[model samples]
Target: MSLPQPVPPSWKDLGKSSNDLLSKDFPFQGFALEVKTKTPSGVAFKVAGNRDAKSDTINGDIEAKWSDRKHGVTITNTWTTSNILRSQVELENQIAQGLKLDVTSSLHPDKSTKTALINAIYKQSGFHTRGALDIFKGPTFTADTVIGRDGFLVGAEAAYNVTEGNVTRYAAAVGYNAPEYAITLHGLNNLKTFTASYYHRVSSDVEAGAKAVYDSKSTHGGVGIEVGAKAYLDQAAFVKAKINNAGVVALGYTQTLRPGVKASFGLALDTTKLNEVAPVGPSHKIGLNLVFDS
Candidate 1:
């Protein structure tokens, strides 16, 4: 008996380089699948006025790429009772070879289904500086503050690492989103964001990360910070956690299920100040995720 031969992990290597000198741009192709669900309790129950649980969603993203640092395309389909049905196709490319400039944009076809929740989620994520009490529990309510359906986003990123490989590196990016077309609703427009982060390899099995983020809108802007750690158990498994100043934290676990495929799941807990006086207690959330990249 030859025994079952284990397929070598590509994501572990795709995250790094082959020759080591670094070839940021190489032609590559891949495929991925995932089914995710989130349920809320405590604060979520209070804010959304839901006596039971939030809705469940199953989404899949199919993607193809030339390489880690090259151009590619992705198609995503999301299904939810609230969203009904939504799909997106995006194309991206890099320019200014030395400066790391890249342009990205996407198009929506069966769009209006999510007309109300898209903007709501952004606001919940701190769409502006003035924090709002935006919650995206499900399609049960027609939120007074948000518009549903058809939206588009275009953005770019640029980064040049003076020094590479774990010791230290800096990167910056900016992007924007807007409503594409709507017959009976309006979506927030001119949303902008920027991010900068540093990576430190504390040791062979561990690393630390720090980042600053800002987002701007017509009325206000938001600023936040995040910190995290990553640990590798071996060549096939790893785990990480990230926390923000607002008391939001996420823990993720991942492993290579096959040579060209990997899977992951993340659990998250978050609390927002609600832009009010008394602090709102943390809202608990549980989520599951899976990914496959060929």
Candidate 2:
């Protein structure tokens, strides 16, 4: 007999398809670029820079990582322009067959700010669990678990304030998965907010999704809806667009220039404000991203 496989996705990733389409590749207020390469010693390096037009400021960060596939260990460090250094170490399948552990720390040069966090995840056929603890700050503890079988999943998550001796947050989610589409429903913030998301792959090159959210704690208590679609123009290019109930529309186009280079363009406009007074420069926002990987 063949061994059964584990559940396809974890609780947090239940609605990732529609979420990524609606959230990713949206325009920003700045220009960003990133370059990644690997050295002969098997160390990976990434450098990223951003320039904000409104603030007229430039900032960047550099990250380096070393991984050992045989031992299942990885170490990474990042240095940012704000003089903060972050380091992380990850170990997989060291203690158990389906277990992973992560340790992360942050340090500031000029300030006394220091923080550390530890996380662990374990997965098996039909079950997944994760736990995280903050060591330096409130010393908070959080945990979540999901049980899945035959395309049905249910999960719950909660965070506790160790110092305060109280539960800070709790949420639950249920989902169903299929070959071509997935659907999920989540009750977050102690059941004060609810969200429903759906994703479908129409064809090999076309995809569509939608999400709806309702918040009982909001001042207006309204339901918000967003629909989006993505289509691959060809092997090297694709386009995405999404519109929300507030009349905000976002469009994105990405193209692979070469084997190691990619470029993306994004535009966003507020249709409700288009009839108002014209802005000084332009009434819409545009963003550009260029990436190179080797």
For all candidates, the clash counts are 12, 0
Give the TM-score of each candidate.
0.37, 0.94
Error of 2 at 126 (Å): 1.3
Question: Every model's Cα RMSD, please?
Answer: 20.1, 2.0
lDDT of each: 0.36, 0.89
Q: Which stretches of candidate 2 lie over 4 Å from their true place?
A: 1-5, 275-283
Candidate 2: lDDT over CA atoms? 0.89
Q: Among these predicted structures, which one has the highest lDDT?
A: 2
Tens digit per residue, CA lDDT, model 2, 47-96 = 99988756769999999999999999999999999999999999999999
